[model samples]
Target: MSSIKWPKKRLKRIVRCKYGDSLSKENREKGDVNVYGSNGVVGSHNKSISFGKTIIIGRKGSSGSVHFSENSCFPIDTTFFVDKTTTKADIKYLFYLLGLLELDKMNSDSAVPGLNREHAYSKEVLSPSYTEQKIIAKYLDKTCASIDTIISIKQKQLELLEALKKSIIHKAVTQGLEDSVEMKDSGVEWLGKIPRHWKAVKLKRISKIQSGLTLGKQYSGNLVKRSYLRVANVQDGYLDLQDVSTISLPKKTAAGLELKKGDVLMTEGGDLDKLGRGFLWEGQIEKCLHQNHIFAIRPIKSKLMAAFLTLITTSSYGRIYFEATGKKTTNLASTNASKIKAFPIPLPSKKEQGEIVDFLNKKTTQIEKLKKNIIKQIETLELYRKSIVHECVTGKRRITDNDLKE
Candidate 1:
């Protein structure tokens, strides 16, 4: 460790307002900065606290997050305030140091996690001289800000790439590759035109769609023996068999609705976004059937590739159609076989369909790889930030003039 010295018992103070009497938006007047829990800035108020240049800590709901403001501010019941001590400790340094501390670890494990003010006040914090503290804080502020800016730019780039992928999928499914080629009017309103050779057909004309068995009505005590698929098992573009639940269905029902490879599974009722979400079943699970809220789509193979059609149905174009036809309640949207059958699909020749699937497989594989790389970068940045905070606050790494110059 670099030679940096500070007194062991640095003086610090903790102050907090009484519960129930804390500031509120209604009671707070104009010109006051209102501070809430860890989330910060719930509302503004006119009343101001007497203390200036203080650090605030979230006391309940969201504990551990620290905030620093220049002037007077009112903290609500869910938070506590800490002003400067008379010792040589720097307030700004303390603010950043407190942020590095994971105070949520100290919370009581009740229905709503809470932090005791007295317990938090007694916690120890390492501190250097006020002058050195300011220098270290300034160095961190500048360096971390640059790193944060770069991370934000990378995040935005990732988002743009994702949007581009979505746009490509939407365009490919809605309109054929060649715009200027001869186009024929499709009978379906949504499907404006298709390649002259292609046709528009109802989903029902090309596939069999049916809901699964109802839940709770069937239950098997042994999850391993009777592992049945649930709505959770069917993700938007993939199947997650990790947490398959078991259900005891009658022997006849199991035989009637047994899932087969190549069958497309879809969710029937849920959030608007997930209403018609589906994936293809590629696993070999004997006696496995879908739950009540899922729909199984069995495609008629001549004109459709199971993978390609599933992708189109789960893409943005399909979402638009499903949303348009689904009946919306308070929190759920649903569609029946009739509505599903009426939905239009643009049908291409078997050769063209196969080519499109091959093209998508190549393109989507690259996109998925890029996404994984970006996710890894994000995780690395988070770990680096945590490491920096831990080393700096613990005096394991010391800030020097050379570091500041860099």
Candidate 2:
């Protein structure tokens, strides 16, 4: 086995500056990349800084994220700037190496997580020759770029599949399976057609929509250790119990508004695209109560499957209805009880509805599995990129320009 060694040295000669007093109104202008502190480029400014080919390390908020810019730019006070004199390190090699470091692990917990430059510079680093450094950085740039391209293609494929799934659901619910089936005019303006025997009815006809309980500030103190469901618990099409919180509420309140199995929960307001995100309650938690930001839809009949309604409400057709009726406030919009109740639904026979739900369950499950596999492939590619960078930068692996030619 071949062994490679990295020399240990003090990064003593590097010039460092904490991002502060670097911007003046005279020097600053709009449209230039404004180097933010921890949160990244929060805004843009025309002002430039003295650091050339340097690495900017976020000190607070987003500690340890390293950004390398070839041109002059302003660095915010929450960031630490490193210039060319920083040891004998190759700027590109160090940038790539820093990318591999999980800097979040080093954050000091105070009012906000932060990094101290003195402590950061004192940390140990493996060093290789400048020529070897360039070779490794160049190889990584090319290889990872290629891998990223493939991942991008796969991601687009996933998006296309999602669109196709929505199209299928929209057609199945609105037009039914039989292409030759006679279409009756849907009385509603947005709904163009319905199966000959199907009825078009308002959502109010089949379900009662009510917002969840508004736990007052006093209720915050009485939170119990039992599982509590909040707006975050409700995801796009399902409930995520991974980070469920425990809050205490009066037993009466819990019993009065507690969620049950087969209940459909929807977000009252959120990002415009997520305003009406709804999901079926699979009964993951016992005696769970929802926050006021969620709405519970209780069906009138056992024939109305919560899962089928949830699918319809989250479908493209449902999203259009939600967007049309939702009241916009800034970036968020909400669908009130009246609007939700007035929303139109295409009613098919209970048997046909069950068949459609079963068919979609099988198809969507397969698509979701494929999506998960593609996501894993993207993660593996990222790990491989990091490994290649580590090995090449540490001299364990070597790449030459001639290798690139081959």
Candidate 3:
């Protein structure tokens, strides 16, 4: 667009890069120099892969992401680093050009999912004159930095909103909607203070806990193919029943394990943070049962409500209890029926529970709606960023002083 006739050049003539060593993440000692993988910096080390302008390209997993660092970098074997000295191209411009190519989807090796260096070399790129290239690169650097700053601020807002949601839930559940209500110690250290009208009751006293049967080939007894829930189906405060699968179970056994309309489904075990995650089951299917890895908590007392129970379990109180009491292995943890029953929950009046549930449902829906809008804004900004890069690098958009001023 700037009157510099873009010339086609074989990648090998303008780009130079090579493979690195097999330094896996666990083996390396931590240091100051960044270790570049295909997508970005994976870790840091005292030693560097190369000095000066380096463009790291994914050679295997997360293939084709283009990353450029001005200083020295160590790109691991799963990546390729192009030498800046060998090419007449502007390094920044080339990096933008690589992103437009979407090379990660061009994985050539079927078995290992790798980028063939020969395939990369055989491709052609449109080259702009040096002065025009610098103009375009400089304009984008300024524009993108400003856009990134906005994105960073928006991301922080999203994080703060999440924390605020947690605080609101904690206050509404523990302190009660009426601030004038007298407070008392919950006896549980995490639950420092609760409303005077509330009573801390062990889950076993208020609810009946049951786990589902594990499906296998040998089972017989009017075996019927029916849908069942696993850990994946139960998420924090909600169920994801979009991809339910079927299994063979005895009709009697399946009936015994069947979920009801008001049943609360919870994950038995998973990542440490994943424990105690669950939601209400609204009878998504007629003949569905959960797996052994999931727990079904049915209310035995009128004080407990399914929606209220979900909020409490997914709240900070539930997470803290699981982290401290659940049997933990490394980063993974699980809770058995006994442990789950032992959990303490604050019992409020049925009316108060319903009111709290309604209030939270309305508030969280607003927060979630706001969050979705912010997320869409971020997505739009990212798409705009990509469009600018493509337009400039591919010669669709011309760069001028007026453009730079804008």
Candidate 4:
């Protein structure tokens, strides 16, 4: 089998490129041609700004993402398109070549982040003969497509695993493991049949729901600023405190709103998915208060466990209730203090609650580890995909027809 010989060349020697034209969103009319962005097609527009096969390089914003369009399309001003006027090399090859060059690392703007066209053009690139370029691009186009499809499948697997974990949690908490034991209608249709012994209770009966401190509002009493949890800090069933910030509140408010060891923290509301997202605050930080957008629930120690409460709220049954009751608009939904207080919770023995929480903690952790492994595989495959593209385009890995066999 004969191997293809390739020659090294500078990018400027191979092709010409320039920034795309400005097109305002308001002025654009809907049509057939794809509107290209630095990363990919942003939308579709009626008029075509560039003709034929095009390569779009990010000039600003996304800075260095490259996208290709086979048909004539509009590349917005946020990007630079490989000019159709003085084109020499295979556009598809140049697309892969740019991927090898790591153009995104060549950011020029300190403030807004941009790609310097001259800097980009001066970079050295391997130029294969037209026939060899076509062969290489074809191999990559097919192989990368396969890899992407695998990644998508693995991603879907991850989604299924997560859903399964949630299902396990929901079942263990609501129905309990002894499925054959006596079951009774929960009255809440979504909840279905729970254990016969369990009692359904409103949140207000077992916990004091208190709203957190309000930021940017003047208070009557003397106040001081303190660290607080924002809506972003509380995630579904967990807290991410990587970027915690402080908010000012009256000393009294701050003191009253401070998180206790077993206090369950829930966001007031935001987007649909975020409506009832929360987690138990196990004294993660000292003197940490929450924003007005978040509410801290002090559950009566004798009646309930914080971990159990968080799981119940995150379950599908609780999610159904909150989404239905929340004040929803086109994009945002909020569960007010009254609704949150009136939330229905299944009351089981404190011992049973502790057991369920313990089971969930262990089970979810195991599932998460499995998910992490799958994610790592996806990441490895992705990195390998990028490496393959770079290797083929840069002549680091010589292309051969036999590669198609493997």
What is candidate 3's CA lDDT for residue 385?
Answer: 92
Question: Considering every candidate listed, which one attains the maximal TM-score?
Answer: 3
Ordered from best to worst TM-score, the candidate numbers read: 3, 4, 2, 1
TM values, all candidates: 0.77, 0.84, 0.91, 0.85
Model 4 RMSD vs true structure:
3.5
In terms of lDDT, model 1 sits at 0.71
Better of 1 and 3 by TM-score: 3
Per-residue alpha-carbon lDDT of model 1 for 235-258, expressed as tens digits?
656677788887665576676677
Question: What lDDT tens digits, residue by residue, belong to model 2 across residues 1-406?
Answer: 0124657543433334355444544555776665555665656686656356767778877888888777666777777766664446677677787776666567776778887666665656666667667767677778877888998998998898888888888888778777899989989777788888988888788887756767555564454545667887887666778987666676666686778887788887777787666788867788887777788887766456676687778677788888887899866787777787787888887888888888888888888888889889888987887787777656676666675653
lDDT of 3 by residue, 77-179 (tens): 9888875665677878777777777677778888878887777787888878888778888988988888899999999989988888888888888777897
Evaluated at residue 338, the lDDT of candidate 4 is: 92
Candidate 2, position 406, lDDT: 30
Given candidate 1, what's the lDDT at residue 317? 77
Collision pairs in model 2: 19-77, 29-46, 223-247, 223-248, 224-247, 224-248
lDDT by residue (1-406, candidate 4, tens digit) is 1224556666778877776878777878979988887778888889887778888888888899888888889999999887466476777777887877878888988899998878878987666778778788888988998999999999999999989998998898788767687988888756788899998888999999878777777666576877888888887656788999987667876888888888877787778876775677878889998888888888998998888888888888778888888999877888888988888788898999988888898999999999999999999999999999877876777767687666
**Candidate 2: minimum summed lDDT over ten consecutive residues — where?**
9-18
